[model samples]
Target: MGLSPKSKRRLQRILPFGVIWFVIGLFVLFIQEAATGNKNINPNVVITLTPKVFVFAMISVTIIGLLVGAVEILWLGKLFNNKTFYKKIFYKLSFYTFFLVLTIIIVYPFAASIELGLSPLNELVLNKLSNFLISLDFLSTLGSIAVSLFVSLFYSEISYNVGDSVLMNFFTGKYHKPIQEKRIFLFCDMKSSTTIAEQLGHIEYFKLLKAYYSDFTNAIINHSGAVYQYVGDEIIISWKFEEGIKNNNWINCFLAMKQDLHKKANWYKNNFGLEPTFKSGFHVGEVTTGEIGTLKKEIIFTGDVLNTTARIQGLCNSHNVDILISEELIKELKPDNSLEVKSKGIAELKGKEQKMELFTVSRSS
Candidate 1:
């Protein structure tokens, strides 16, 4: 069976760390060669970079990287998910440094044996390994590993904060200039957020919102949705026009989100004393997308479709429905036999000169 979307995302995040470590390994190799020059400090400790030994060294560092990445994403990240940014970095750095030291102790003997054409259990190989570990070369490798870990942790934190897509865009300059494209957006707002805040108090309500959005992220990412913005109690998800309509993903994404929340209803009730509910509006149209700002750069979308979608979402409370979509967008969607869609009739929306037909969608049992 193919990996689930969530697992694919986790793998994507983990693999980059391995690549970073491999690159660092290459740099370390060069630094070591430069330091050793034409002579070895110990006559038995030769610094030869044979093709086979070089490949072995590269593979070793890569495996170390993959192991570290797995631990970071699966264990450390979750354990420190709610901690402060610096705290997360500090803990991860400390853990990675310790792991690096342990890796050197265990793997260096085997690697040295390969370079020297002797069994790792051989006395000369052991003596050479001991000399290398006590030499300045070992300290240099430790310094390099420490620097790499610190930089990598900082990169991961920034990537997580700005989001993976946005960071990629920044690095690639894909949206450096404004361009228009048709896109679909799902704007979801938590139901009774104001009342919930009043009931829970500021701190407790923020915690609820944090959990609520974190769960929503799983559903959105699984469905190939990009989180555009989080406006207080509302989250805006976006997709390329074709990507959204393919497999009716735009609609399925929302349904999946609803299902996810429902599955976690008991947890929310137990933790926050109430099960949170949400309403959403969907629309598709052209928008100018690009990187904006000098002091604080960001990618932003500007279009009337956003306003119309928000207005449609506002009608949900009045129409007493969980989801509302623009007639224009509904027409673009492929037929889904499992869906039951009803016309909510044409209505003049707020801040709009023309009226638009709206629809409410539900899953058929």
Candidate 2:
């Protein structure tokens, strides 16, 4: 799709990082021009540019790109995707600070040492400790920290809201055009949501919902499941045919999600005086995928599969089952020795005339 709301907001935040650097570069360029007379308005005083300037700029750009891109893609990507990591903002800030200093040290001071033979990697220089510390430009390191912090903070928030892959797919417009793709769908909903809401009240209840979904987000990302939508307390998760089927990610996602929440049960109970519980249903089928809407555009799926998955999850309460899967999906899944599947028989889902065969999936205690 063409710049969904979330994508636009994130881009807007990231754009400042680029703009700040561009403006600083321009300011430096102007200062260099005034100092060197590289572009005198008077025709008689035309100063030629030297290769040294080009060499310096190229080195700086290359060093900055390598250092920043390496950390961003490898470290930040993982940190942002893990919802639990946000709870540890101190660690995040510490890493950012350390990375900023380390990157600048390697990119400039340490690199300069290698070329100049002024440090340990080369020949030791006179007053080695003093010279090495003096060689480091604290001003430039601070600048790097300022820019990195802004970018990292913005990215962390966006990744929390959408996700790393979702942010990328949003910008790439991967689902902009409509196409039918076979996929696995898992509809997971909070159990006893009404009672929880009433007990916690509206404002505090929202916090509980947030914490519950955060756990779901972590599990979903861990299993490579893309979040299709969040309806009320229900989270709709999907995966491509290959991704969902291989390694049984579709199956594990629900189980893992349960475990993630269960681990947080005490926190919920202490904070909100209640433990959170949820149920899920899974199915696989073809769905029409496309970007829909304008003011608040979203990548969405439209097909009977989505409805069927929802209905299947609804059966969880009646059947007293935590997870249910359509028989169609079960055929493709090979249950491990510890995992077990029990036939729930045919279920005449809501708004559907056909009675669909269903099965309950569980793990051995």
Candidate 3:
């Protein structure tokens, strides 16, 4: 199968570190060789910082960066997910420090042997490695690595919290001034959330909400949906107009989420004594998008579409359906055999003067 958007995004996040380290390696090499005219103190070692040596160093450091980034994302991130900020930093630094030390122990011997044109087991090479490990050069390299690690980790944390696109927009000032853009929105709300909270109590219900929201991550990312907001039990996801319409990603995303939740029904039942379900309303329209606020800043969308979407979602129970879409958005969806859509006819939506034609959507078995 082809890679999902989520997988592609993960790879995108991981690869940049290697490229960055490759550049850093080049800069460091230039400073040491061309700028400072530094030379190796050990007479046994013959390899100087030539272009070939620089290339080797760049490739090696890039490989190290790839390995470190992969570990941070796949292993350490999940391991320290629930940890406090400072605690997570401390633990990650500790583990990576040890990892770097171990890497030096294994790689330095081979590297030194190559330079000396001798076996890694040679006494002369071993003696040089011993001196190098204790020398100021090793300490300096370690210090540089430490600084890079801290900065990268900080960037990753901020990116994760604010979202990649949002952070980029902030840096690029794309949304600094309010701009009009057509976008698609999916307003998804939990079914009978208040009743569930009452039954489970506040704390347990909070846990369920957490799990519920977490389960939607794969489906959202896989479909290229950006979560706009998390208002209690409801999550609003947004997509570019073309993105949502292409391959019917907007509807497919909802179906994927439904499938995922159903697949985990047993687990939910075992843990929470019940399984949670959600209803969503889809609408597409032009909205004013911009960065707003003084004390606490945020990128917000303001338009009638949002209100209409929420109203559509509110009608879910009245219609005894789990999904609803505006007539205009329905026209945008390509005809597909996998989905069955039925018109609910024109109706006066609450607090709105204009009548709207709505539709209920379901997966065709």
Candidate 4:
């Protein structure tokens, strides 16, 4: 499965630390072997680390890591999104605990096996249990656990900071700022979002919204669209079209988005006695695209095109239509006979001076 940018960044962040720990574990094993007056380190270390054993260890670590990360990212993070002090402490404590448990479970055994080599099952078990209890009293255990936890949490924070910095530099910095030009914008808003929120309550409503957002945004990204912003009930996405013309990719993008929404509608109806629906509008025009704002710079699109798209989407509520495409967009797509379009005539938009033509597309041919 494809991971989100955030997930990918987290993995990238954790990987170096994992590798470093693996190396340090190997180094300690080397030192222990040398201290025994051994002539050389194990040449076939990779072979000595049995594939089955390593695979089992990796799988265990992955499962545990996922569980811990989920608890940290989803549960605890959500509980205190607004409370900075408590959230920081909770995250630190959770990170330390997770790292300690995971290291003890996954790393300690490997270290013991390397240090002692292969031994009888009974001896191995006795040695491990004895060491486990004794190690609890050793300062080395506490120090190593503290170091590992600190490293892991530090890596995670660094990754987030670095990724944000990179994105900001690329989008907002002087080098690439010139490429951040205007483009077509689209915004889709869920109808009766407040009603759903009221019915579901805050927690349940957030869960539903998360699912909806993930599904819809996945579709958008698949179509080479960038989701810039998500308001309370709406998402603003933009795609750069050459010469303001809609291509096959853009059409496929809309189709995928609509299909995603349709699936969510079915899910909402089945699960919550609520049918989820949304109205979307697309506009083709010039709009600046780049990272904006000084204190909290954000990647965004700005101009009349964005506002017009929102306005057109709002019109869907009154027009009784689910999708609306602007005339400028239609010119780029070349409306085919397979789809039916009804002209709503020209009307001046909220922020625009000139009247723009709008049309609603339906399945009826």
Per-candidate TM equals: 0.92, 0.68, 0.89, 0.55
Question: lDDT tens digits, residues 1-365, model 3?
Answer: 77878887788677766866677766766666664457754454323664555566677888988888899887888899998888888899999999988887777776666666789899988887777777777887788778767766776677778887887788789999999999999999999899999999999999999999999999998899999999999999999998888789999999999999999999999999999999999989999999999998899999999998999999998888899899999999898998888999896788899998999888887
Per residue, candidate 2 scores C-alpha lDDT tens digits across 1-365 of 36533344445444534444444444555665787567535221121234553355445644453444445445664665555545545555666677666654454434444434456344342233234345433554365455545555655456556755666567778888888899999888888998888888999988888888878866676676888787888888889989888778888888889888999889988999988888889889999988888897777788999889989999998989889999899999866887888998889999999898999878877
User: In model 2, what are the clashing residue pairs, if there are any?
Assistant: none
* Deviating ranges (above 4 Å) for candidate 1: 1-3, 35-46
What lDDT does candidate 1 reach at residue 10? 80
Q: Considering TM-score, where higher is better, how would the candidates rank from best to worst?
A: 1, 3, 2, 4
For model 1, the local distance difference test gives: 0.86
Relative to the true structure, candidate 2 reaches a TM of 0.68
Model 2: per-residue Cα lDDT at residue 140? 42
Q: Which scores better on TM-score, 1 or 3?
A: 1
How many residue pairs collide in each prediction?
A: 0, 0, 0, 2
Candidate 4 versus the native: TM-score? 0.55
RMSD per candidate (Å) reads: 2.2, 8.3, 2.8, 8.1
The sequence of per-residue lDDT tens digits that candidate 1 reaches over residues 149-194 is: 8766776788788987798789889899998999999999999999
Whose lDDT is greatest here? 1
Model 2 stretches astray by more than 4 angstroms? 1-106, 109-159
